[model samples]
Target: MSDSENPVDIFRGFLQVLKSFQILIILTALTGLALLVTNGMIDGDWGRLSGGWANVKIFLSESLPLDWQVIEARSYPVCEQEIEFFCSTAYIGMLETIKIAFVATVFGFIGAILLSSLAARNLSPTWLSILVRIILSALRSLPSLIWAILFVIVVGLGPLAGVLAMTFYTIGYLGKLQYEAIEGMESAPLEASRATGLSHPEIFTNVVIPQTGNHLLSQMMFMFEYNVRHGTVIGIVGAGGIGYFINNYLKLFMYSRVFSLLIIIFVVVVIIDLLSMAIRSFVNDQGDVRRPSWFTVLLPAKNAVEIHHGSAGEEES
Candidate 1:
């Protein structure tokens, strides 16, 4: 039979066309739903959307010439340093936010590592994995803002509250990422370790961690950056950070000052993104999207070399 006329070939082509048509239908339905939601949100007043540009123009006019005064020392504090920027509200708030994020990320990373090990099916029993996943889901269900408000009420308003809130959220978020990474690991080493009667702790530490080291590092860095951005939200609830100043400025209708603080935050977040990229480069020679789990790391040197060459040879075909 000719290639195109073969029953298998015709069936495969039909399936491919059906798949493309299904994708197009899904996209069309999603677009229609989005439009419906937008209409509902505007209450049929689409004209309001046209006025949005005017409102934006007015906001820009009021906020432009970004206030450099925010970086100057406050009147009450009595500046101790020769450089005034150190004592400024912007600096103090940003520094506090960074500190809270750092501490929370560290604590959360440790807690997530423990919880994820238990949550991963490869490492723990099915019942234990489900229980731990339920716990993580509970933590993640409430956002950092709600957690911050709760902590603020319990601990009083400060960076301490921010730290606690972010820590809990980070644990949930990072635990999900960690356990998934662990579960995605190749089963060869795990099976071998089990056959040799290695302890759970030994298998986890010696086999699982090394296999997913790059993924763990990348997830931790991402969580740290996530926590940093969330600091502003938590701080708005009196959890202490740059967002505290931002909230105050908003209340006082000082848009220029708020804009200035946002600029500072943008700069800080950009720096953090760059730093995260650099740190991930240590484990991931490839880009962020292609973090291959290095399971061969668990094999003996000779076996690892053979596997590497074998994979490379296969790829050439």
Candidate 2:
């Protein structure tokens, strides 16, 4: 039989067509589901959506040149006013937001370190690990916004509520990340520690923690950065931050002040991102070459010495 008419070729072609049809069906189903959700639950109207776009076009046409020119002409005065506002109100709000994030992250990191150690499959009993995994998973499933709303009701609307929400969310997030890091650690060091008749805690402190210190630090920095952004969002529900002011500005239609606040937020986030990057780079570079005092604080001096000796013995053997 010709190649085109061969049974094997026909079967392969049929399978390819079946696969393509399956993918098409999946895409169609997803599109239909999205439409249904938007229409039924969200009350989305395509006509209104189009009208909104038209309104945006009109606003852009009207505001682009004349309004922009006016703002530019009075830019110096506007800048002075914004700077004063920043110094008086926005700066304090920003600082409070940072404080909330820092405190929450610290508490969360400590909790995560404890929970992750027990959650790790290689470190703890199977039952304990499964239970911790379930708890962390449940915590992680809830968004920070929901937690913030609940806390707002309980605590009566403040940064305290934000702190609690962030702390719980961070624990779940960091616990999962850290446990995976612990589980992925080199088996050799752990084996050596066990062979040396070290206790579980001793092996974990000396080998697992030191090996995964950089990963933990990186995860902490990431969580802190995320919390900073999320902290602003949680404030929208009166949990306390720059978002409270943003909501106020929106209510009053104070677009210029809102724009200024956005710029300040952008600058702050950028600075934080850069600082985190620098710190991560420093950790990666100095982590192995020389154990910094901070590193020893986590893995004590005696433990470090013992680990070094163990590694040397392993190499010799």
Each model's TM-score, in the order given?
0.82, 0.66
Q: lDDT per residue, candidate 1, 175-211, as tens digits?
A: 9999999999899999999999999889888988888
Query: What value does the lDDT take at residue 103 in candidate 1?
Result: 97
| lDDT tens readout by residue for model 2, 1-317 | 79989999999999889887997889999999989988986576667776798888865564333221212223233455443444444565677788889999999999998899999998889999999999999878888888899899999889999999999999999999999999998888888888899998887787888888878888998898888888778888988887786677668766656666666777788888787777777546654564434444678779977776676678799
Q: How many times do residue backbones clash in model 1?
A: 0
Best by lDDT: 1
lDDT of each: 0.90, 0.80
TM-score of structure candidate 1: 0.82
Q: In terms of TM-score, which candidate is strongest?
A: 1
- Report model 2's TM-score to 2 decimal places: 0.66
Kindly give the stretch of ten consecutive residues in candidate 2 with the minimal lDDT sum: 66-75
